[model samples]
Target: MPLILFNKPFQVMCQFSPHPSRPTLADHIDVPGVYPAGRLDADSEGLVLLTDDGRLQHDISHPLKKLAKTYLAQVEGTVTESALARLRAPLDLGDFTTLPCQAVRIEAPAWLWPRTPPIRQRADIPAGWLALTLTEGKNRQVRRMTAAVGLPTLRLVRIAIGPYALASHPLLPGEWQEVSPLEMR
Candidate 1:
């Protein structure tokens, strides 16, 4: 079984199928027969895992497995301790409640590459960075969570999934590399 780690770019759709306007994973990865183990939203960027093995995909994505996914979110306005506290607690997001996970204010990572077209900037409102780790994923969960606490996300990036991390294996946007599945264990 082949597992691939791809550095997905912002605004790139997470599917292999063609889109009417935006680029898809097919536009970046040419390796056939492989599908994303989990998904990253088109507006979001960074580490996405793809694999050809069904069982491996299931193991990586299944919520029951509790594989930690870490994201770097640049949100509008300064992050307060109150907001961080709310994020650290189990958050009620209407449809489902998010499990309590690690949420912390962090300095902007030095290794982060600038997003193309860049995130919108305002002269008055300052932006803050957060490192959030979640065991479960929901559609637009991070964005919604931040909004619930009065901070809207400007840029979102998934830097790690389970044992694999972009910090250890850095790849520029639209880049990818094949890796052994055993490393995931």
Candidate 2:
């Protein structure tokens, strides 16, 4: 099995195909036959795994598997206790209700790299950092969750999926490293 851990850069598309107007995984990844196990929105940045193994892809991306994904968010306001409480509860996002998850305020992670074309800065509105762990991946779920509670997400980055941490492998944006099935386990 071919396992790849890639640090997806901001503005990069998740798929391996060439897009008409946007950069795709093919722009950075060259290993044929491997596909991204899951997707990250072009506006979001994070760790992404690619694999040629179909079963491993299913295990990693399937929501039913309930693999925990850790995220570090820069939200556009002081993250209030009420906001944290709301995030920890089963909040509804119109389409569906979310399961309870761990949410907490955290200092900026030292390992975080500066985003190119950086998130807009505000002279007045304060921003805060938060660490969130969710068992399922939803479409822009973190952004919607924070927005619902009056805190808009400025930037979002997935630091890990399950036990595979981006920090543990030390990959920079658009960089990829190969790993073993045993190591992934």
Candidate 3:
């Protein structure tokens, strides 16, 4: 079973499962027999994996595999190095301490698309960019982590998963393509 990469746009659900009002993978990817290996929240966008192989799906989605996923997040508030340090450290989210991760503030790039329903903005308030990476993907982990550090995520985009990257397969919203790699690691 081969893998396909999709650049899931904001507001697109990760599965073929339909919502009463939102777009789904069925609306974007028409390939038969392929299913999403993992999920990205409808509010979050980018780098969704689809595969025909069940074992490959397990490898990518199961937390035990610990595949590294990297995200470029636009967050509300000026992110200080201290905040980055907090993200890097264990985050006691009551149930579990998030797996050790890396985060840092960087200049917001100009290439991102404007979200359909733009993130709420306060003229007096500021926002910054953060490049964050994690292994275990608990529910909304990045968002929760940012909120815990006092920087709410305004926009989130997964840039890469393991060896596959959005940079190599740049698809606009609602687009997908077959990854021609002979083998997946």
Candidate 4:
């Protein structure tokens, strides 16, 4: 069983399961035997894991494994240092408090691909970066967390899964590649 790293693009579903009305992981990934290790919402993008080994999938996606996932979120609003600090501190998500994590602002780069249906452009509104890390992958957690902090996420990209980064692997949108065994740890 080999591991695979994919740079999932926006509007792509994360599973091989078919959706008659929506595009799924199947539409992009043709590799047989490998299944997604974890899921990214169809609206979100980047750094998805696929593997043939069921155990490996469990290790990567299981909550017990606590594999830290890192995301570079482009959020709407003028971000302040206070907002960054708030993200690092514990967040009460109604059901439970999120674990303490890391977050900060970053410069926007031109390398990002233009979304097919671009986020509504508001000339008066601004956008900023937030590097968020979490051990738990809740349903739309990152987007929800940003919204809770008054910064709605316009674009989300999973920069890394454990030690592998989408940048290093570099899969453009629908592309995917099998990771060498040495890199799967």
Candidate 5:
């Protein structure tokens, strides 16, 4: 089985097929018969697993599997302790309530790569970083949750899914490496 860890670049689509205006995994990966286990929005960037094993894919992507996915978010304004508390609590998104999640203020990740278009910032105000871990993969959940608590996410990156992480394999943006299925779990 082909198990790949791909560092998806900012503005790149998660799928293997070509897109008219945006880059896709096909531009970075040439390995045949592998599909992305889960999706990262074009606006988000980071680790994405690609695999040919259906069981492995299901394990990683299925919401019922309750695998943890970690994100590093850069938000406008310094995140207040109260806001952090709200983020850690179960959030009501109206469509559905989110499961309790881990949220904490973090320093800017020392290892993060430069975003291509770059995140615009105010000369007067400083942005803050937060490390958030969630089990459910709701549509734009991190962004929405932060917005609900008065911190708008300016940039987002998915750093890990389950036990797999970009650091373990050490991939730069748009790079990919094959790993064993055991590494995914």
Candidate 6:
């Protein structure tokens, strides 16, 4: 089975199917039969795993498997201990409560690529970075959690899924590479 790691760019839809207004996976990846194991929002960027094996995809994406996904979030204000505590604990987001996860402040990574149409900046309000690892992924959950803590997310990037990491397998936006499925084990 082929396992592909793609560095999805912001604004790119996470599907092979065509979209009238935005770019899709088909625009970047040419490998046939492989589908995304999990989804990243069109507004988010970074590592997305694709594979031809249905079992592998199910294992990686199924919430019951509790696969850990880590993200780097650029938020609108300086992160505080209080906010970190709130994020580290289970958070209620109205529809569902997020499971407790690892949340910590991190310096903006030097290797991060700039977003094509850069995130908005304000002279008065400084932005900060956070590394959050969650076992359960809910729609727009990270963004909502950050907003609940009083820091709106300006940008989001998924850095890792389980054993694979963007740091170890570097790829610029829209780039992808194949790896042996054994490596995932």
Q: Which should have the higher lDDT, number 2 or number 6?
A: 6
**Which parts of model 2 have CA positions greater than 4 angstroms off?**
183-185
36-73: candidate 1 lDDT, tens digit per residue: 99999989999999999999999999999999999999
For each candidate in turn, the TM-score is: 0.98, 0.97, 0.95, 0.94, 0.96, 0.98
Off by over 4 Å in 1: none
Ordered list by TM-score, greatest first: 6, 1, 2, 5, 3, 4
C-alpha local distance difference test of each model:
0.95, 0.91, 0.87, 0.85, 0.91, 0.96
| Candidate number that wins on TM-score, 2 or 4 | 2
Task: Give a tens-digit lDDT track for model 6, residues 73-156.
Answer: 999998999999999999988889899999999999999999999999999999999999999999899999999999999999
Query: What stretches of model 5 exceed 4 Å from their correct place?
Result: none
Q: Which of the two candidates, 1 or 3, achieves a greater TM-score against the reference?
A: 1
lDDT of 3: 0.87
The window of 10 residues in a row where model 5 has the poorest summed lDDT is 176-185
Clashing residue pairs, backbone N/CA/C < 3 A, model 1:
none
Comparing candidate 1 with candidate 5, which one achieves the higher TM-score? 1
What lDDT score is found at residue 1 in candidate 1? 75
What is the alpha-carbon lDDT for the whole of candidate 5?
A: 0.91
Q: What's the CA RMSD for each of the models?
A: 0.7, 1.0, 1.3, 1.3, 1.1, 0.7
Show the colliding residue pairs in model 2: none
For candidate 5, lDDT tens digit of each residue in 112-154?
Answer: 9999999998999879999999999988999999999988999
